[model samples]
Target: MLHRFDSFLASRRRFLQVSAGFGVSLMLPALEGRAAERRGAERATSLITLWMNGGPSQLETWDPHPGTVIGGPTRAIDTSVPGLQIAADLPRMAERMKHLSVIRSLTSKEGDHERGTYFVKTGYRPDPTVTHPAIGAVVPYQLGTDHLEIPAYVSLGGGEWPGRGGYLGDQHDAFRIFEPGNSIQNLRARVSDKRQERRLSGLDVVSQTFRAQRQVQAERSLHGQTIDKALRMMSSEQLEAFEVDQESEATLQRYGDSSFGRGCLVARRLIETGVRSVEVTLSGFDSHANNFETQTARCEQLDPAFASLLDDLRERDLYDSTIILCLGEFGRTPRINGLEGRDHWPGGFSCVVGGGGLKSGQVIGATDPEGEQTSPVDPVPVQNLYATILQQLNIDPAEELITPIGRPLAICEGSLIPKLLVDAG
Candidate 1:
C-alpha cells in the first residue's frame, strides 16, 4: 500500500509540472497579442526633431530680450500670437507662432557638446554602466515597427552626435542620409536579378550552416534579423519617400533651396509613410565668435524650412498626429564673450514643441530679462520634456525595461509638463 501511494504522488507531481509549463506557453502568445494590439492603437503618431546640432543662442532665437544688456543686437518681433514674439531673425517662424509653443526656460547640466547632445537626445546623463536610448530610438522601441519597411528612425544631414539606439540595440539606430533628395547608394543590385537571387540563396545556405554549427536559431540572431530587414527595405516602395525632388518647384521654393530645407521636406514625406521618428539636423549653430552673423545665417536656413513644414503638415491634415521638437544641445550664454560670441550655457535655454495634440501659441516659462539672474524662471529639466513627449505618444514614462546586465531602468524619471499637453490643462 505504501509503495502504491508513493507512485501516485510522483505521477501527480510530474503531471502538475507539465500542466504549469503548458499553461505558461499558452499565456505568452495571448500576452504578446495584447501588447501588439496596444502598440498598434498607440502608434498612429510620429515625431520630427529639428536638431540645432551646435548650441544656438536663446537671446538670438526663441527668447530674445531686445533692448536688454544680454539681448545683443538681435531684435524681437511680434508673432501671430498676441503676446508672444521671437527673434527678428525668424520672421517666417514668427508668423507661424500660432502652431508652436516656445519653452523659454529649458535647463540642463551638461554644457559640453557631446554630453549635452546625449542628455538632450536621451533624457539621461551619461552613465558608463549603460547607455540610454535616444528619444527617437525609444519611440520605435515602445511603439513597435511592424508597419514600417523603412527604418523607423531616420537622421537627415547627419550630425556629429546623431541619435543612437543605445541599450535597445543597433536595430533601432537611425538610418543616416548625408543629403536629402539623392538616390540611396547600394540599394539596387549591381548584378542581374537572377544573379542577385542566386547570391542571396548562396548566402542563406552559408548562414544556415553557420547557425547550425553554433547551435543558434536563425530568428534569434541579430545579424540574421538585420539582413532580413535590409532585404525588405531594399524592395520597399517606401524608399521613394526620400525623393524630395518629386515636389513642385513652388513647393521647393517655399521650403528654400538649402539642404536643411530639403531635409525638412523629406521628413514630412517619411512621416507620411509611417516612419516613427525623423531628425533633420541644422548644424553650424555653434557661434563661439560672431554670434550675431552666425545666428542670422542659420535662422535664414531655418525659418522658411520650419514654417513651411508646419504649413504643409497642417495642410495635409497631419499636424495633430505629428509632434515637432526644435532644440539643440544647449544654449549660448547670456553674457557675450570678448570675441563677440556667446559661450555654452546649460543654465537656461529655449525649445519649441507643438502639434501631436499639444497646446500651442503659448510660452511655457521665462528668462530673466535683465540677464542678471542666470537661472531661468519656472525652469524645465530635460527629463520633464521627454516625459511630456512620451505621455503625448501614449507611452508610460514610468515603465521599466530590464537591461541585458539585469539592471532595470525607467523610460523617463520626470513628471509631465502639464501646460504643454492639451488634455492636461
Candidate 2:
C-alpha cells in the first residue's frame, strides 16, 4: 500500500492550487541532517543530468556504426581523444570528448518509455510493491542539502517523469520549473507586507485549530513545513541562480537559443549555488519515424548546450566536483523500420558519463558492428551505473533505507565499474 506521504504527493497539484495565496507552491523538500561529510578528496558534490526524454538512437549519437547497413545516414567523426568518434551531428561534443567517457553497452529490461525512464533514473525496474527514489533524490538525502534555501533537487523543462522523492518523502521530490530563465510565479505577495503578515498570523490560528482536531497526525502534517520552506525560498539570494538571462550574449549564443540550452546554463548556476542535483530535460527524441532528421535536430540543440556546460564547469574549476550524465531512457533499435525510423531497444545502448573524478576519454563497452545482435559485447546493467555514481558521490551503495511500512531497501544493488573511476584501474 502507498504511504500517507505518497498520497500527499499524489494530490500535490491540487494542494499547490489551494495554497496559492502563500505565494509559494513549489514542493520544496524539508531537508534534514547536516552538510555532507566528504569521504574522499576526489568525490563529487553535485550532479547534472542532461535527460533526453525519449530514446535517442545510439547509431546516430554515441555508438555510430558508420558504413554499416544499420548505421543509417549518420556518419562518425573523430574527437579530441584518439579512436573516440561520436556522431557527426555533435561536432561540439566531439571536440570536448577528452572529458567524457562513452558507455556503449548500457542494457536494461524495461523497454517501455515510462518503465525505462523509471529504471534508468532510479536504477531499478518498476516495482508495484514500492516507489523507488531517483538518484537525484538519493544524492541530497545522503549528502544533505548543505543549508540550501533553494531545493537541492531541481528539474528544468519538466518531463513525463521528473525525479521523485519516492520513499524518501515529498521533501526530496524535484522542484519543477517548466521553463528555464523564466521568472518564478507568485514569489512575491500581491498584498502589502503588513497584509501578508496578518494573513500568515491568521493561517497559524486556523492551522492550530486543525491540528487540535487531528492531534495524532498533526505532527506528520507537511502543511506547516511546506509553508516555512516556501517563505524561506521567497527571500533566498540563491533565487538569482535561475536567471540564465543574466549571462552575456556571447555566453548565451555559445549555449544556443534553445530552452534546453538555457536550462543547461541554469543547471550550471544551480550547481555553482550548491544545489545537489539538477536535471535538464530535452524531449523529441522518440523518433519512431524519420529517425535521421529527428536525431539531427535534437543533436543541434544538445551539442552546444552540452559542450558549453563542460567548458564552463572546467573554467570554473567545478568539473572535478560535478558528475555529468547525458542519456535517455533507452536507445533506438539498430534495425531501421519501414518508416525510416528505429524502434525502442533496451538490449544495447549508449550513454555518456564523466567528471566527478571519473576517468575520461574511455569507452567502456561496444555493440556489434553489424548491428544484428540484440545484445552488446559487455553489457553494463543500469544498477551498476547507479553504483558507480553513488560511489563517486561518496555514498555507499550497500547502505539501506527503510520504507514507510518498515521495508528495508539498499540504495543501489550493483557493483562499481572500476575502470570508470580515476583512482581505480
lDDT of 1 by residue, 347-395 (tens): 9999999989889988988988888888998999999999999999889
Q: For model 2, what is the alpha-carbon lDDT of residue 50? A: 95
Kindly list the per-residue Cα lDDT of model 2 for residues 1-425, writing each as its tens digit. 22223455566666567656667655343334322222224333899999998999999999998898999888999999999889999999999999999999999999999899999999988889899999999998899765577888999995788888888877787888899988887787777788888888898898899888987666665777778888888887778888876789999999989999999999988888778899999999999999999999999999999999999988887888899999999999989999999999999999999989899998989999887777788889989998999999899998999999999999999989988987887
Model 1 / residue 145 / CA error / Å: 1.8
Q: RMSD in angstroms, all models?
A: 13.0, 3.2
**Cα-based lDDT for every prediction:** 0.81, 0.86
Model 2 misplaced stretches (Cα beyond 4 Å): 1-11, 27-44, 216-221
RMSD of 2: 3.2
